[model samples]
Target chain A: MTALAPAASPARTPLGSSIARTLRLGVLRAGYEIRVYFRQADAIFFTFLFPVLLFGIFSVAFSGQGNIGTAPDGSGGISQGAYYLPGMAAAGILLSGVQNLGVDIANERSDGTLKRLAGTPLPVVSYFLGKMGQVLVTGILQLALLIVIARVAFGVELPTDPAKWLTFAWVFLLGIGTSAVLGIAISRLPRRGKSATAVIIPIVLVLQFISGVYLSFTMLPVWLQDVANVFPLAWLAKGMRSVFLPESFASAEAGGAWQLGTVAVVLLLWLVVGIVVSRFTFRWIRKDS
Target chain B: MNNIALPDAVVSVRDLAKRYGAFEALRGVSFDIHRGETFALLGPNGAGKSTTIEILEGYRDRSSGAASVLGTDPQSGGLEWKSRLGIVLQSTGEQGDVTVRDQLAHFASLYPNPRGVDETIAAVGLADKARTRIRALSGGQRRRVDVALGIIGRPELLFLDEPTTGFDPEARQQFWSLVHQLKAEGTTILLTTHYLDEAAQLSDRAAVIAGGELVAIGAIDEIGGAEARVPLVRWTEGGTRHTERTRTPAGTVASLSARLGAEPTDLEIYRPSLEDIYLDLVRENAEAAAAEIDADGPTSPTTRPSATDPITEGASA
Candidate 1:
């Protein structure tokens, strides 16, 4: 028998196999996150349905009086159902995208999942993209349910015009994307502190109240209204109002437009800020600080 | 086994070092692993065992060194090189309560020509748990999953870092046998472990790393493995004790047989196991640290005694 085997041809790595590897990596991340969300359905239940539930309580308590005592556009007593619908949508979007993505990503990075993914052929960017992909899929589904609940249960009028629907769709997706980035950016700031929700709660509440989602901008002290106008929450509330409410109900002023554009711009800025900070942050192991 | 003769070297290293900030985890660590054989890398926690294995596996970069694995620089090797390499990292996350068979099948899809999932599961002796959800599996079962993933690729060079850490005694023995089966299939294994018995059982050759340096390397039996050190002998002489150290234990037993005119009462001959020598080496390492001392290098006669193990040294993995 021969001591050494004869030479053989050089091996070729199959192209199909490499593609399979990369796709599998993405699939693993997305699948695991979905499973995690399902496992923690109670938390998810509060995240999605609680915002709509809260809207039901507040809309009727202040119904028929109009959110604004003084209509800047001079439309008299616009329906409370109309005004609050858009604001609630914005609040729902923020509650779902920012709170969910920010907290989950932080916890994933902390737990060895991100570190494990760091070694795979999957670039860290792919993991975030997969997360984005999952969030978008869930957001659309959540929005559909919210719209049905509003139109059918709460007797809130939704836009039936096709052009208005297209506008609604674009702005809705954009708002989701924008706020998602801001949430991610915000998530980066509290890296060392491990209790993700503990840190995010105060920030979410402060923005929600001060941005005038709970109280109408028209009735807010002029100073508070102006301050709200300068933040993304104000923009989200105003832009969303323009979508679901009658045009006459919107503040016929620069501030309403400022509300939408500023939230978009600030969220985009936070997105950039988040990306930069995450690059510098040392992701701790998943279980501990 | 095939009639193939091993080459001079499959792995070659010179002055390998890795540092994390102020700590030098591996200081000028160096050793060679030969072709078609098992080489154990042994050390305690924080002894740079993981760092060295990671570098060899191309998962981490080294601070400084000229180290070649399977003839390619571990630092710069590409997919062409990586295709021939396999790595089982220390821990893998649960793939969300997936069935063991399904997860193995999914991972098997990544390799161009992977071993069948069923066969791999059987090899790791997880046939009983094939249908079990991965989340329900014990730590040892999870490790079996890790090993299944690693070898699914049929890599020529395999890196097993702490592969049997959570394994039960029976599972550990089965794992050792599975390793031998892989060797029969010509997969060169680089193993790191805290268990000396595993090193003695699985490795044809072994290396010990501590404080970022290669303390010793050679055939497992001679590289300060149990065989290099003399066996301890003791007997009762009229209620008093007697003792001696020698390389020949059975011969010592023969002498005792002749002297006592039968087996001597209370005769006990203790052969040095890999654990005994390993403890001595690690202890010697600790003492050397305390005394601020550096011992003689590879020139130490005991280290290079005789490379007479059947597994050949070589330039292939």
Candidate 2:
């Protein structure tokens, strides 16, 4: 058989001309990621269903317990269901964003998935975009599930004003974005797939406990409040609370206000931190090299 | 070692070396793979085969060396450069829940030009299992999936690292035929294996590596030099056994029979196979290493024999 030289067509193809094609491939990768994610029974149960289950249990247990606590303005206390609604929704974002990506990316790195993809034409940006897209879509579905159950079963009142809805939209977007980036950053901490959950779960669990997801923020001591304020989770939960609770309820927060400005700034800051950390941490192969 | 890159060489390496702390994995090894040629790197376990391929694949960086794959330095190769090479890693843990077809289709989308999903599946002999989840497949079947992904990109140079490690004989035959098909289609392949028969059957040229160094490199029939392949004549005479290495076994046997005035008892002629030459090369390298240690003022008796133990153990089975 006659021999042929290596094909020269794609060798000199400039990166500038392939941006659109890379984006298309990224979208295609997202479709594949979502399909595979849904097929896993364990992933669906832990990521999507866990938060909804928590909402059900909390609302049912505290059904007739009256208000969670009284407001300073004497306008009346916030209902137990309404107060926990936003907290659980925020937790949903954390689950789908940080927890999901941390373990998933670690597994990919250890399993040769990242190495195989690295050898291909797929850009690293496209890989991250696929992950971010999965988190965005799954995070939205999870939030909707929590919100629907809260409103229908527990008779909780969601805000009707367009301004409040706008607040919810931006808060949700920023929260998931920061969470996705942080997830990728922390994925490098695990040395192998089996230890990924052991390494990541403790961190996520500690954040949920201290960040006002499981308990009332004002009830937490001042020291714990200060610690939680340093992280993005606290800001994310507070942002969600502002969207669902009455404006007067800001008096109950640690700062004695909703602090939407600081919430935006802190979450934006953490997003930058996550980006910087991941730029140095993410690798196509294991660290043995 | 030749440092100049051949005009049509798809892969060229010169004085390539890798060090893991104080341990040297590859010690200044060099080779060239010409366009559309099937080149095999044959070695015992941990003889730097995978290390060399990983460096060429850009999965690992060499400690000190020069490597050119597809006419580009692998360390700086970009997406355009990566798109032209196919890599089948030694072992991989790919997504198990996805169907074979879905997995192939997704990977196919990342290439500028890729083989059709169904076509690739059929080419790897997995047509019936296209809809099957990867986790449900057997070990050999999963290996085929790995091959399917590697070739789906239509790479100009394909790296197959111990590709048929888990395949049965029939499956290996099928795999070889598939490789032959790729060769016929002008796909350059670089393969590493412990199977001498595989190297003899599939590669136009082969290199034998021992203890992180290449000892012999040439065409399949010419490796280890003609001296290593000389015919051996052995026979028993007067309650003593004698053996001679000769170029013409027939003439030697005739001379021996005429001198003895009858056919020598239990006369036999043996021509060394590829495996015999490989074992001889590895043994010679080990002896040289042992002699070097002796000249350095012998440290221990215990460590000397261990150097040659692996060669004997590997050759036994």
**Mind giving the per-residue lDDT tens digits that candidate 1 earns over A212-235?**
677766666788877865666677
Give one digit per residue, the lDDT tens place, for model 2 in B1-317.
23467899999998888766555767879899999999999887767787788889987778887899988888888998988889998767666889899889988887777777887888788889999999899989999899889988888899999999788898788888888888987889999988888989999999988777888899999999989999999999889989999999999999998999997999999999999999999889879877877887666322322232122112112
Angstrom error of the Cα, residue B295, model 2: value is: 3.5
Residue A250, model 1: lDDT of 46
* Model 1, residue A105: C-alpha shift (Å): 2.7
lDDT of 1: 0.67
Off by over 4 Å in 1: A1-32, A56-83, A180-193, A217-233, A252-289, B1-12, B58-60, B68-85, B92-123, B127-133, B152-154, B225-227, B254-258, B293-317
The residue pairs in collision within model 2 are none
lDDT of every predicted structure (CA atoms): 0.67, 0.84
Q: How accurate is chain B of model 1, given as a TM-score from 0 to 1?
A: 0.82
Give me candidate 2's TM-score against the actual structure.
0.91
Question: Chain B TM-score for each model?
Answer: 0.82, 0.88
Provide interface RMSD per model, one decimal. Answer: 11.8, 8.4
Assess the local accuracy of residue B243 in candidate 1 as a C-alpha lDDT between 0 and 100: 86
